[model samples]
Target: MTETQRKVGFLICLITIVLAVLDLQIVSAATVPIVRDLDPDHGVDKIPWLVSAFALASAAMLPLYGKLCDTLGAKRVFTGAIATFLLGSALCGAAQSMEQLIAARAVQGLGGGGLMSVTMVVIAHLKGPDEEGTGKGGSAGGLVAGAGMAVGPWIGGLLADHASWRWIFYVNLPIGLAVLAASAFVLKLPDHPVRRPLDYLGAALGAAFSSALLLVTDWGGNRYAWSSPVVVGLIVTAAAALALFLWRQTRAAEPILPLSLFRVRELRLGFVIQAIVGAAMMCAIYYVLVYLQIARGVASSSAGLYLLPMAIGMSTAGLLSGRLTARGWSARTFTLSGTATTALAFGLLALTTGPATSLWLIRAALLLMGLGLGQLMGQLILLVQFAAPRHQLGVATTGIRFFQTLGGALGASVFGSVLARLYAADGPGGDVSALARLTGTAHAEGVRAFVSATDVVFWSGAALMTLATVLAVRLPRPGRPEDTEQPARQPEPVPA
Candidate 1:
């Protein structure tokens, strides 16, 4: 591919990633309008399904998408995924009822699964011979994602309030169509000559496990009690499916997620660190918003604006890290520094929690948190890609994303339960929103209690990030004697 073609391919892939991120963040802001227009009477009850359906279906398709990328080639898989996503988006825009819309979201998610993961594969392929793939494209992708996160909900709110709710989905069509067309013309992906039989049975089992585990996390202790039959049954199902999937992986001709990849220390550490960063991100974003909305009495839309500083921090770090990596800074150096920065941010957040704590202080901590995390996502994937065998690039890239998504789900569930328990022990029992409705003294007490609970949550996040820092210390530094094993294992080093 020529220079102009590479740039175009990169642009198309980034737009596709924006589509994926926007869809995830966009829906929440439009829900109230959707409920009113679709089924005001019964829609409220089914609202959770909107998020759940997309999340479950998307998670379920990830492993399969990775395999498809390697076999069919990234360009073919990329165009197909975009076409599927556009089809689903059209269906979503035209849906007349809540049920239909939810179903359409599930369809959209099937394609959405690849929008980010496979795009990373494509980006890695875009690198020219002699160009450093030290995460330049991945860092740019991260910056785009952070911008999308910062602006997505605000854009959704703007559209839903001023235009039709359907336009939210409709808006994706033009942009997505353009991306799809450009990719087909511009992306000249390397061909994979060696074809192997796909493990359909293993894929099915893996999908089943991912779906069940996501459901267990989403529904547990919120929609159903932890001990309820529904949650218990899902737990058993997830366990059985996971066990069977692992067994199948060991025996399959081409496993969906090969166990052999984990034997590489860099790949293993990269995966674990990616997961920890994902979970910590949930703590930073979700709990901060909760605190703002419930305790500080900030409106939801305005509360979202608070994330801008963090987003800026993320974008800046991504850009800066790309330059630093080019200057001989190893992935290990960034990992250690990033993890330590995030841990300190969390520790500061935990110590400063109070009903009257300044909002600016929290914002500062968030900015620090983002700076810390920004260095990890792209660089870690670069590390894993460098460590993994060339044949396994697709699975390895997607595997990082898979672990992160699971980590987010599990962390959200666990932290949510902890917050609930801690609050119930001190505050008047019920939703944290109740704190918003309380009057003077009671409201003051509620704020204090909520602050107290979030303090613990931040501390927990701090502890987790600290643990990641310790693990990062073990990562092999670039150009060092310890790093020789990784390059020795990947003799080809995955072509630029």
Candidate 2:
């Protein structure tokens, strides 16, 4: 690949990353408008499915997407993912009812699963033959992702308020078409000459397990009681599927996710730390928004703006980390320092946050949280890529993303349950939702209870980060002989 092709491919991948991250967040600001226009009477009750459909479908396809990348090559897989996503986007824009939109979103998610992970794989391949690691590519991707997370809701709000909610889905079409066209022309990825059989049964079982587990997490104690038959049955199903998937992996000709990757110290530690960081990030971003709305009396739209400070911090840290990486900073050094900084940030939030806590102080904590998170986000992927065997690069890259997403889902459920239980024990009502209806003394007491519960959540985040920091301490020193660099494979030419 020439330098011009590399630059164009990188740009396309970055745009795809932004689209993937933005779509996940943008719907939040338009839910009310969506319900009003689609099914004014019953759509409100079905709104959660809009988000769940996309996430469930996305998670279910991850392992398969990675396997396809390795077998069929990244160029073919990447373009196909984009085409599928754009088709879903068009269907979403044309949908006449909430159900149609939900189905369309699921279709979009099938493609969306590959957009981020496979793009990273492509970026890895974009490196010059003599170039080492991902260089600045990972950092650039992380910075864009952070910015997208920060601005997605605002952009959704602007579209929903000024024009139409449908524009949110429609907006992807032109940009996606441009990305698709550019990628087809510019991405020069190698095709695998040897076609490998995919582990269809293993992939199916893995998808079943992830789908069942996600449903359990999303519905437990929210949509159903913890003791409800639905949640219990789902949990059992997930466990059984997971067991079967693991059993199949040991025997499959080409497993979707190779269990042998776990043997590497860096890959093992990197996955664990990434998951914990993903969970902790939920506490920082989600709960902070919750606190602002309920306790500080800030509007939802205004509360989202608070994330801008964190985004700025992420950009700053990512920039610095990239430069330092070039200057000879090891991945282990970044992981250790990043985890420690994140733990301190969460601890500060736990210790100082209250109903009357200053916004400036909260912003400072968020900024610190971002600084730490920035270092870990990109570096962990690079770490896993470097440590993994050459043949399993695709699975290893996606595995980090898979664990982080799973952790975030589990964390949100657990933290939400904690907040509700604590609020029920101390506040006027068993339901925290009642706080919105409370006034005077009741509201004040509810706010106090809420703040106390949130502190516990932040403290739990601190403990998790502390554990990640300890794990980071055990990473093998850089330049170990075991860390063998894989030679670049020869390419099969892509057809125009």
RMSD of every candidate to native, in Å, equals 2.3, 2.9
Per-residue C-alpha lDDT of model 1 across residues 1-496, encoded as one tens digit per residue: 9899999888887888899988977888889999999999999999989888888888888898888888879888888888888888999999999999999999999888889889988988898755544766877787677667666777888889899889989999999988977887888997877677999999999999989998998899999999999999999999999999999999998899999888777888888988898889888888888888887878987887888888888888888987777666777888898899999999988977677788889889889888887887678877777677877888998999889889988889989999988988899746565776788888888888899999999999999999999999988766665654445234433434
The global C-alpha lDDT for each of the candidates, from Candidate 1 onward, is 0.85, 0.86
Lowest lDDT block of 10, candidate 1: 487-496
User: How do the residues 64-134 of candidate 2 rate in per-residue lDDT, one tens digit apiece?
Assistant: 88899889998998998889888888998899999999999999988888888888888878877555554
Tell me each candidate's TM-score. Answer: 0.96, 0.96
How many angstroms is residue 358 displaced in model 1 relative to the true structure, after the best TM-score fit?
A: 1.6
Cα displacement (angstroms), candidate 1, residue 359, comes to 1.4
Instruction: Name the TM-score of candidate 2.
Output: 0.96
**Cα lDDT of model 2 overall?**
0.86
lDDT, model 1, position 495: 31
